[model samples]
Target: LEEETEIASWTENGGLFVGTNAERLAEYKRFAETGKYFGIESHVLSPSEVKEVHPLLRIDDIYGGVYSPGDGTIDPTSVCNAYAKASRKFGGGVYENVGVSGIEVEDYLTAGSAPGRRIKAVLTSCGKRIETPTVVNACGAWANEIAAMVGAQIPLKAMKHAMVLTEPIAGMHSGLPNVRDHDLSVYLKTQGDSMAIGGYEQNPEFWPDVDPGFAFGLFELDYDTFGQNLAGHMQRCPVIEETGIKSTVCGPESFTPDHKPLMGPHPGLRGLFHACGFNSMGLMLGGGVGRELTKWILTGSPEVDLFSFDCARFHPESVASSRWVRDRTHESYAKTYAIVFPHDEALAGRGSRKSALYDELKSRGSKEPLDYDLYGACAESGLAFWLVDQGAYEEGAWRLGEADHPDIPKHQSHEYLDLVEGELTFDWPASHATVAEECRAAREGVAIFDQSYFGKFYLSGPEADEAVQYLCGADIEGKRAGSVTYTPLCNSRGGVEADLTVTKLQDSAGSNYYYFAAGGNTATKDLAWIRKVLEDQNFKAQIEDQSEAMTLISVQGPSSRRLLQSLTHSDMSDESLPFSGAKHLEIAGHPLLVLRLTFVGELGFELHTPAESAVEVYRAVQEAGAKLSQLEGIPVRDAGYRAIDSLSAEKNLRHWHADLSNRDTPLEAGIGFTVLSKLKRTGS
Candidate 1:
């Protein structure tokens, strides 16, 4: 950008992140390892070595630090101007001081039975209508407002961020690198002869309402709130204690519920895209974001695996709630500089969404009935089942122990007291043994998992078969109805966009419909991808998102078929409902669509039941498991996600976002069998 635009927008002053404790220092070491894998230049420094790099540090209590020589600061204003100038040079118009008043959309009839909406024009505040087929909502803090005009939403909120500049120091220079004391949540940046100091507060104030004419606006610095960071700044850099304050700058910055930027096409509207909600890292990530977003706009997909930052990651209902957005945004902002443990779960805005069998699962292992008012009580009780966010719903993950475990406290007066803390760690947690037990059950006896969070969808119409064949890498040409094919939805470059199962089912009227089961977190993203493909190809297929209406209960192990047969009147023989086959069965007196498959390398069945009947079906399964346990001496256990991970890992089952991503091809990930033989021969 600097070579082409000739804009001096960046200063290569390097950056340093220092740790104050051993745990944080260990985290730095792990980060350095990751940086090495990515071919990034990074060095782990001791306290004395850190001081050598930056002499201003008070390293007596500091453990260590990590320094990146290539990490530097950029001038946001200059970069923005450079982008505008470069865009104009490329025959792209750069409009400024123009606010979008409304988005014009028209409902168009498609070859399919359902109709779709398309962007027509954009109404501006200047009373001029800009006729365009696409509009990018890169409006920063006001992005949600722009999305609202098109009847779409993004989970973003604006918060007041304040920083202070100290008086010119006697020996400060621009060559000094920026310093970050993450433990203290304070940072120092060189500003000519002075320094700019800022920090992320534990409880930042949210700006729910922003004035329409508040562009480039500043708010009065709240000394009371800013004082929390000011003390840390002085403590980290003692020289700041003697230096006088020059000025305080407070402004509104946008943030998201998960702290990741929202970048993708709008799931609901065609030709509408989102590129905002950077959570204060816009300036740092703008260049890459711009490059990738340009590719996404030109082509139908991006090169990188951006599922983590996809705009459709959040549920529309969750983003629509103002209180949910504020609470989670505050938590996300406060943890900007905190160590991210592998098992860390967000504590805010929970309990709002739950599966149908939430209560049934909670009551099974608890010593006493848990209270609904106690937040995270199940996590600390005798059951020790930790509930985690699975998209919009709370799903149980790991169990520390059973009711009879010695680690659990026997007595408790207050529900919140005697809670087990520090369960979120990078090392082996106390639940390791419990998870191993659950894995044993899945490998030996029967193990049941409440997989209600799995995303379910249906695709049927005149072109349903063609759409599936075109989108999937596997050859589904001759697969009969009721056959399940585990395939990867590949992009044009043969990258694995989504790894899931497609079950072919025929209705009573003899119309073929395909059922899709995907990861809960990637539901919206996968759905949007399918819709985009359908629109681009003009396929007359009707897609329905049944994620909220259906619940999935997985039963796996050597005895899984026997256990399921006891509960249902369906034929248990391989010839009747063979492996990788679907059947409509009556389980526990409730209708269910059962699919025979396994992620844990065992015989398993996935019961797809209505949400309302999930609790009853789960209860019936547990009761049958108890009876089978007495007869066989091999217990049927209730498994959590942790156990699922262990079981799947043993089988080398690839997870969508973790083991496999959009950056990898099915062949490279050791799943070449899922790809078509012709494509492999052609090297496509």
Candidate 2:
């Protein structure tokens, strides 16, 4: 969606094309030419002004070309070399010029009475043993075989692909762009002094014959015969005929049933990771996939957007036992590069193309979406889109296959998804673009989701700040009356059980403190746990539950100040008053607990107004915030579970259940300081 850049300008760096058209199939009779037509400007050369750029072409004989300023030709060998050098730059262990013989899988992941029953170590052909907690099969092309050794079947196959380079002609300049006749399914790009034009193989079908085992390897090529195929190609770039002869490279291009990459752990095989099946396009997606791979191994989070290419989706068991492996592989050859069919129709008890955009996505690049609602369901919705388009949600996880999974609730206490209402009660991923809309509405004017359940606590006494500092992780010592601090409270055992904001309040009555926590366990457990801890210390603060009288409506986003300013006489800007500050103010002619703070990381306010006036303040924020329509504040970002995973990983924050292994410690997880230093010592 080019929110900030052009999508058409992305690099089409590779030179391999699989499959071909019907007409070209007849001409390349001796050789099996496969793949669809994809002609573009070579490397960096543009395709749009071809005839004008290269006067040697007869416009009629030349097919339309690419004038892409974004496209550039790259030397494949150089890319691999750079990658190898970079890998060594870090402490990564790399082995070269070595061959793997086979692997040994212990039948099960369970340990026996003795010990180490899951996996001992792998014996190499050279009689060396490599023992580790996990093994990543990044061995390209050979991934499927390695997976099979561990009893995990992968849909990986290898198909032969070839590239032809023409001899340099005298008039040929080195600046020609890569050109492809989309109709003919052939592409031509220049490399150094020579022109590297391939995809002349008219067919992309893997099997030369109906059988997969018919033949697999780079067959010999005739230069003169190859030149004949470019008869009309030279008409587009007249300088091409001036070039002499050159060599060609044809080798096996690893492929999968669907041309997409295979990522994530081997489903049935625990502790095994697969990062293979790139086909020819692997290099294009390497960086993102490499990062995701490291994350998955350390955290057990599925590789981002990984479900679509999960190795478990396809079952070799589906193939008839009588079916030859080669035959099965050949039938799926076209599917590798063909538009991908969403990996559905295989989930338990669900196998129908019933979705509206099902067939459409099968033929186009779908839009990815990331969605979340305030209560907590963070879901990324997958929408089927044929071509790229511009929008806030475009090109996000919203349309990825993995984005559809229901965000499994964190707390079993309350059912997240209500089958009765179809309303999710958790912060979900697929609901983000929508929730962000709701958030924007509230920030600008006002809106409310059911904060009917936010956990609330009222603590009051002359020793209020002291009591708060003792029981929670906040330095209430510095917060003057009417100030608030958003703090994350750690459980006595040192886990983040609550994310609450503390507000010091005052009136003619006296100064008191209010602590509102995130919903679900984030609220209820927070107050109950803190109260238990404080009461144990015999603290003098009076703690009471105020959940019944208060309704928490977080009015956040840019229009927050304007919305509140309209209802109350309070000046809300940093210059006028300040922020992370609050006061009881009149809103729509009613007393309200309007705390000028936010959670969506914006210049918004959290109105802890009375429940009776909840809808009023909500309406007020909506009305007043509507008038100040400038996007002055940072947009609230809720990127769902995957995003949270990344953030938590960076913060060295461990989820109580997910990241907490049997022996993991605060020090090992890097949160020891947040615990012993902050909580155990100077804390209650």
* Top-scoring candidate (TM-score): 1
* lDDT tens per residue, model 1, 1-684: 888899979998889999998889889999999999999899999999999888887889899999999888898889988998898889999777988899999998666666788899999889999899989888888887888888887788988888998999877788888999999999999887899999988757677787767898889998877887888888888999999999988988889988999897888788898899888889988888888988888977788878778887776667777766766777678888888876565555665556677777666743212211111112212124334332112111112111222443344332221122344567876566777788899999988877766779999998888888887888776689999999999887778889889999888998788999987667777887887787778888978889879988899999888888888777977999899999898987899999999988999999999999998898898888998999879779887777777789998999887888887989888898888574765454
Best by lDDT: 1
TM-score versus the correct structure, for each prediction:
0.92, 0.40
For model 2 the local lDDT of residue 107 reads: 51
Instruction: Please provide, for model 2 over 198-247, each residue's C-alpha lDDT reduced to its tens digit, 9 standing for 90 to 100.
Output: 54332243422223222333655644434444664564456666665587
Report RMSD for candidate 2. 17.7
Candidate 2 lDDT (Cα, 0 to 1): 0.47
